[model samples]
Target: MNIKGKTILITGGGSGIGLESAKQFLAEGANVIITGRNSAKLEAAKKLLPSLIIIKSDVENEEDAIALLDKVTSLGGIDILYNNAGVGSPALNLGIANDQILKNAVYEMNVNYFGVIRLNNLFINMLKSRKEAAIINTTSILSLVPALEEPTYAPTKTALSFYTRTLRKNLEILKSNVKVFELLPPVVATEMTANRNDKKITPEQLVKALVSGIKKDQFTIRVGDTKLLYVVSRFFPKLAFNLVNPKKIYASLK
Candidate 1:
């Protein structure tokens, strides 16, 4: 897709991958607008990129989704709706039955999966009207192989991964102009993964790869370790599972 001269709206744009995406997209000559639930973080992002149009909105809220759509429409709409907002609950052992396990799963699903659907539904029409438009959904490598430490978080991404594919195929069947792109990223060094000692990629590297993939029309953009995991899981499923949930991670869970 031609990102230059197009307008893009990114969710959770205050920091991490979203912020890096905004910077890269803007540098690529696209008009950028960012949304987040934190007002202070939004302001901080605005300060970092003076040209960014920052809006405070939570992806998990239905009302906020509507308001965000209205606001984006008023700003002349967007050529790309990047559903990048996601959340994960603290690690908990799924083997031990606990009420908190269900709560955490619901929270993760609400933000990581349902929130993407809500925003996509609201903006589908607008995207279809555009000459060239796309929806970018960020699913994770964990979707391919479950992580022992991220029991609840992994399933959310897996659900979203399925949804993204189905949505893309549905759009294709309808011959819709709105394109769907799924981004599968490895563990990135971000606030969300700050506590982890896992090998990580910087947000800059990930977003750079994402932008390159978008330009090349790569619908399923898998970055870094994600690319390897995809291949490994295809053939050596057991090895791929072991790679993600290593002995160390399993021990940590206990």
Candidate 2:
């Protein structure tokens, strides 16, 4: 919970929320390591933050995950694992071949779901041994309220949300000090939403809220409109579903 003096690892830290989080945690006196597949972006992050230990690694690759553990172990194990690496589903067209759809879905799951599973399995024990530690998974509000636009992407988050909840409960039963936290962020102005003119919080704003939430020991850190979306989905599932999938409603209205 305490960010100071902690060793933190943030996947997909090359940009967006992950980059901002790495910088914020570094400001709080934490040893931060950021990993991504893009060497150019990682290099740029190093130039920008200078203090960040940037690693050119892909979470979808098991070998890269192992290499990442080795890299972090050399710097004294990680106290916080931020599972932030994720991919938005490719544009889904019903006209596309079924094989292509399946292929796209597999890649998305590999990075979004299996990546979290692998890293958690690898470093959970090390974190448990530490006095204070946390596993933060960056899910989305779409997990609670599915969006019509992201058919493939939304399901992955939904699955991860449940996985994180079940993991938290299991940790509690074992009386483990390692905390599990889910970061459900609303639409942010990132590469994931480059063209869309939707309302979005800046990555810095989300990171600020995230740090404050973590400090308060909030297990579910909902950023911006996500907090409202979560509540609506909880109390009014049907309404929430309709609200998020307005395009679907319109298509059916005729």
- Which window of 10 residues has the lowest lDDT sum in candidate 1? 245-254
TM-score of each: 0.98, 0.94
- The lDDT per prediction is 0.95, 0.89
The runs of at least 3 residues in candidate 2 whose Cα sits more than 4 Å from the true structure, single-residue gaps closed, are 93-97, 248-254
How does model 1 fare in lDDT? 0.95
- Residue-wise C-alpha lDDT for candidate 2, range 1-254, written one tens digit per residue: 78999999999999998999999999999999999999999999999999889888999999989998888888889999999999986556545456767877788899999999999999998899999999999999889887767768888999999999999999999999999999999899999999766788999999998899889999999988888887888899998998777664445323
Candidate 1 wrong stretches, greater than 4 Å: none
Highest-scoring model, TM-score: 1
Q: Give the candidate number with the greatest lDDT.
A: 1
Model 1 lDDT tens row, 102-221: 999989999999999999999999999999999999999999998888899999999999999999999999999888999999999999999998999999999999999999999999
